[model samples]
Target: MIRAYAALEKGGELKPFEYDPKPLGSEDVEIDVEYCGICHSDLSMLHNDWGMTQYPFVPGHEVVGKIADVGSAVKKLQVGQRVGLGWYSRSCMTCEWCMSGNHNLCATAEGTIVGRYGGFADKVRAHEAWVAPLPDAMQPVSAGPLFCGGITVFNPIVQFDVKPTDRVGVIGIGGLGHMALRFLHAWGCDVSAFSSSADKEPEAREMGANHFINSRDPNALKSVEGSFDLILSTVNADLDWSTYIACLRPKGRLHFVGVVPNPISTEIFPLIMAQRSISGSPLGSPATVTQMLDFATRHQIEPIIETFSFDQVNEALEHLRSGKARYRIVLKH
Candidate 1:
């Protein structure tokens, strides 16, 4: 039986729970979770924010752990190997997207928490393909977020062929945005940060932003018109997207990694005349995740985090819900 903390009902506090897992599939592996990161998505699921969360929900996806068991068909990973798991647990390996190395786009991709118990536990199982090996240089204590938030931001840079010489802008200096700034800066881009918080200005610069644009300042937003080759919006809050669109250079792109609850509205003339584009994506593919790990290791990029014991799961959830996390939260066993 796997021991875990679970929310028995929607918006409920987590409590100790246990259950016997199904027979492990030939391609599956079980991880003895050492640490897990608390993502906003976990809080969202805890409250059934997406209306797809299951009862007795075990909400954690950014998992860093050692392999405890492996199935007969699993080849790349071995028992006792350190690895990490992210938002996805499984995907239809034969689909076109998966065959083309974009498994994150697989039509039947399984979310780690949608209908399954997740990593806020003593053990969690996933198809080996979705598990990423941790580099020796990456510290397990702070590596949990790399599997989710880190990869979410890193994938766009790889997918879009963001150039080192490109001018890049990042919105929101929270979890995803902070990492995006660091990655873009290390990639050699001229980085700008768009934030409404005055206190975050210095913090943004420390995170690698060369310019700070106050989102609330019309002059600040207007000064950068046609300035960016790419702008990555990492906030879930709705903003004046049209204004962001205007800030993009000709043939530029405004990409989203955040899940805004409302539809984004923008004028067509700005997009048509400038040849600008608006796009969004899920997490990265397995190959991309590996690349991200290697790049992060090479550049020494790590998420700023606060730690909590697994026993303090509810408190950690509340802290995240309160929006008080410095950048990320990790739960250790």
Candidate 2:
């Protein structure tokens, strides 16, 4: 039986729960979770925000753990090896997308918390393909966010072939944005951070932003028109996206890693006239996750995280909901 904390109803408090897992598959592995990160998506699932959450939900995908058990056919991972799991727990290995090495795009991909118990537990299980081994130099405590937030931002850089000398802009210096600034800066881009909060400027620069633009100021927004080669938005809130589109240079791209609640309303003429593009991506494939971990370790980039004991899960969720978490929250087992 696996012991976990689960919400028995929509928006209910998580309580102690236990259940015997199904017989482990020949291609699966069981992880002894050491720490897990709380993501906004977890909160969204807790309240059935996307309307796909199930009752007795356990909300955690950013998992850092060690292999406690492995299926007979699992060849790449060994028992006691450190690993991490992200938003996806499994994907149909025979799908065209998976065959093309884009498993994250597989139509049959399984979310860690969509209909299954997740890392808010003593143990979690996933197929070997979705489990990524951790880099030796990477610290496991703060490495949880990299599996989700870090990969969300990093995938675009690789997919788009962001040039090292190109100018890049990051909107919202929070969880995803902060990691973007660090990665882009280390990647040798001229990094700009856009935020409504003026106070975040200092920290943003310290994290590798070459410039800080007050997103709330019209003039500041205007001054950077036609400036960026790429703009990565990491905030979930909807904004005057046209304004951001106007800031892009010809052939530049505006990408999204955040989940904006409303459908985007924008003019098509600007994109046509400037040859610009607007796009978004989900979390990366396992291969890309490996690359991201290696890059993070080499650059010494890690999320700014606040730690909590597993029993303080409720308080940590509330802190995240209250918007007081410095950047990311990690619950230790």
Candidate 3:
């Protein structure tokens, strides 16, 4: 039996719950969750914002833990290895995308909290392919967010071949954006941070931003036009995206890792005239995640996180709801 805190209904309070897990398959492994990160996506699912959440939901996907059990077919991971699991719990290994090493793009990928219990409990289970071993130098407590938020931003840098000499701009200096600033800085790019909050400038610079742009100021946005090689937007709120597009150099790209509620509105002429591009990506493949962890370890880059005990899950949720989390929230088991 797996013991966990679960919401009984849509937007309901979480209560203690237990259920018998199915027989562990030959390819599955059970993780003794040490720490889990609370993501905004968890809150959205808790309230059924995307309309696919199931009741008795246990919301956690940014998991850092040790393997407590491993199926016979799992050869790479052992019973005591430290590992992390992200948004995906499983993907059909036979798919063309999976075969080509783009497992995150698999059509039938399984979300950790979509229809299954997640890492909010003492234990969670996932296929070996979705489990990534943690590097020895990486601290497990602060490593949870890297599996989701970290990889979300890092994947684009790798996929788009962002050069070290490129000028990069990050929008929204929050959970996802802050991490982007750190990684891009370590990658040797000239990093810029764009935020509506003027107060974030100092922290953004400390996080590795070379310049800070007040996103709310029209003149500030205009001054950087035709400057950036890439702009990574990590905010969920919709904005006048055309202005951001205008900031890009010819052949530059505006990428998104954030989930904007509305369809994006932008001018096509800028893209056509300048050869600029607009794109977005989900959490990265396991291989890319491993690479990100190694890079983070080398650069000493970790998420700015606030810790909470699993028992304080509700309070932590409310704190995140109130928008007071310094950057990311982690739950200790």
Candidate 4:
């Protein structure tokens, strides 16, 4: 067995330490991690908030690594290949969702957070089907955030046909929101950033937001009513949908990738009057993940991130929880 170094969340909070690697299975490929993005989802899993967390859980899903070994039957990947893995670490390939090509929504779709150990360690084991070949030219640390944060926001951006000329509004300027702004701006969309913080205005502009809407200002929101062709809301806080919907153009699409711990409350006018749609998506299917990577490579689009050494994982998580990181936090092995 390969020895790997990692910090452990020993059924409560994360404490820096080491752990042993599990025996590799035939369908698994062993990876020596170069970088792992510290997603807010990781923070969610650390507390066992969703209630299925395994103890000594190493929380990470946005992973980039080098393939150190592959099972004999593995054909899709080879040893020494640069690779990336996202939220999905495993799924029943013959299941209905898999057959219907919507594995992301599968009832039994096992995640890196549950069924398998994730990339919080120096090495990880995962099925070949769940791993995507990372572009050799892409830097590992920067690419880690793309696996989850980039793809979470990017999948809908591509799926819903929000194009270069569309007026796109991104809500919240934190991890996911920041990436959404960059991706939309890079796509040549007329990007607008919505946030409560006045301080994020300059940073938002620097990240390619053409306009910054301070939600604290009524006039700011008033001017943008029915202005956006698409709105990607990334705030996890329970917010009034009417306020968000007011920013959308007629029949505009609102795609949600963030989770609110509480149920949302909103007026019916936004949906009933405008014919606007509200929707949510899980992370990308394995196929779409690769497509996102290729598209990002072609467009030179990557997330802005702060990197931390593996031992400093606790500090990394604290920074993310405090909302102090630029956009994304990555851990290097």
| Clashes within 3 Å, all models in order | 0, 0, 0, 0
| Cα displacement (Å) at residue 321, model 1 | 0.7
lDDT of each: 0.95, 0.96, 0.95, 0.82
Per-residue C-alpha lDDT of model 3 across residues 174-268, encoded as one tens digit per residue: 99999999999999999999999999999999999999999889999999999999999999998999999999999999999999999998879
Residue-by-residue lDDT tens digits, candidate 2, 83-116 = 9999999999898999999999999999999889
- Compared to the true structure, candidate 3 yields what TM-score? 0.99
Model 1 lDDT tens row, 26-88: 999999999999999998888888989989899899999999999999999999999999999
lDDT of candidate 4 over 1-333, digit per residue (tens): 443333355435565546565667788898888888999888877877788777767788888989999987788998999999888877778888888777787887778878456777778777888899987667777998888888899889767877799999998998899888878888899999999999989999988899999988988899999898888889888777778788888999777888887876677777888888888888888888888888778877788888898778878889988878888998887
TM per model? 0.99, 0.99, 0.99, 0.93
Error of 4 at 83 (Å): 0.6
Clashes by residue pair, model 3: none
Least accurate stretch of 10 residues (summed lDDT) in model 3? 10-19
Candidate 1 is scored at a TM of 0.99
Model 2 alpha-carbon drift over 4 Å, by segment? none
